[model samples]
Target: MQFTSEVIIATYNKPDYLRLCLKSIAEQSQRPTSICLADDGSDARIDPVIEAFREAHPDLPLRRSWHEDQGFRKSVALNRAIAGSTCDYLVFLDDDVILHPEALARHFSCATRGRYLTGSLIRLDADLTGRLLEAQSYGWAEGRLAGWTPKGRSQWLKSMPFPSGVMALFDRLSPVAPNFQGACASVWRDDVLRVNGFEGNMSYGGLDKEIGVRLRNAGIRGRHVRYTAPAYHLDHGRSYADQKVKSANRAYILALRKSGETRAVNGIAELDAV
Candidate 1:
């Protein structure tokens, strides 16, 4: 049976990256039911880009849920998208990550009812990222053939042929860990709501893992899909990453883990209450 899923691309003001991301999604073999742009207070420049994308992909249902430019409130923007989405499943992606054509298909095939899937991305160098952004074609082969380096573990799985059964075996044997990466991940909407969504207080760094910790505390397991549903992450300087804020967020998450905290203080409930 097929499940209804939506792709939520959390983005700021990078229209160049967003354009490539949207194009990749549009080229997916197993397209999502809809695509939602979870804009975290970007400027007016993003308006025409999104409109053009929507107009070009007339068959794809594209919508935006935006908030005022109130700093890096990605957690809040994602919560807004979750609240607005009508799909049963959600595939989360950052604007800079360009997915493989089979990325969604792989995710859908591996999706489990009671668990969330955490995937990985190969980081593309600045030079390649620039070339891809300039080119209109969403050809992932160009990057792969050009030898983009995989950033994390299990990236070698990208080259493996489908139906290898390695992913299933890995999921069964792997231990549940708090490595929730928001770059390329998919989860059931109900499961996310159960943990009250991501902590709104988090600044950067450990925010994604914080949600994973809460999910684990709530008895929701995370399946490692790192190699199975891989994407290419564009390399760019992180202007929002503050080391002090990241350290604080990490400390908060560690404390929650030790205390066995299952729900976030500022999360979906607060959003719903508003």
Candidate 2:
């Protein structure tokens, strides 16, 4: 069965990465049902980058959701997209991650009804990221990673996005718990609403994990599709990640775990209440 999907690209002020990110989407073997630019109040600079993507790939369905520059309200922006998206499945991507040609195809295939699929990211050092961002016509980094040096052989292996034919070989148990990673994860729209969507009252850290744990509480288990749907995460400074807020978020999530809370207190439903 073919499931309809929408790709939600969460972005702030990074226009260069956004440009390449969109390019990677454009190169997908299977195009999404639609694409939503989940803009968290970026400046006017990002408009041109978005416009260029639209003009270049006019056939792809695209739209944008924006709120004022109110610090790190990514959860709020994502919730807005989740509320607005018209698709059976939602694939979340960060602005800095570039996709494999078959990434979307893999996600669509792996999206089952009972569970959300979580994919991993191969972190690129800043030097390598800079090199690729500067290089033109190279957003799809599948076979080109041969000469590039990642941390080790294990890390380098992740850069290779295995084609669909060999997927069954790696269907063994996942090493890590299937957690919801923001960069590359897919879930049913119904499941998200069932848990009231992402917690709007959150900071940069632990927000994604909070929703993941909630989904588990709500009986939506997670599946690791890390190897099959792998993507390259670009390295960047985390000036926005405040340590105080990070600690607070960790405490909040721990409370949720202890209480086994499901729905988000300040989520999509709360947004409608105001």
Strongest candidate by lDDT: 2
Q: Per-prediction TM-score, please?
A: 0.91, 0.93
| Candidate 2: regions farther than 4 A off | 139-147, 161-168
Evaluate all candidate structures by whole-model CA lDDT and list the values in order.
Answer: 0.82, 0.84
- Model 2: lDDT of residue 158: 63
Best by TM-score: 2
lDDT by residue (1-274, candidate 2, tens digit) is: 8778899999999998988789889888899988998999999999999788888888998899998898888999999999998899999999998887778988888788989988888888888888877773453335535335668865655655455456434534546787899889989999999999999989889888899999999889988777677688877999997899999999998898889899998898877653
Candidate 1 structure quality by residue, lDDT tens digits, 80-180 = 99989999999999999888777789789878888888876677788877777777454544435244555455555553334537755654565645278
TM for candidate 2 is 0.93
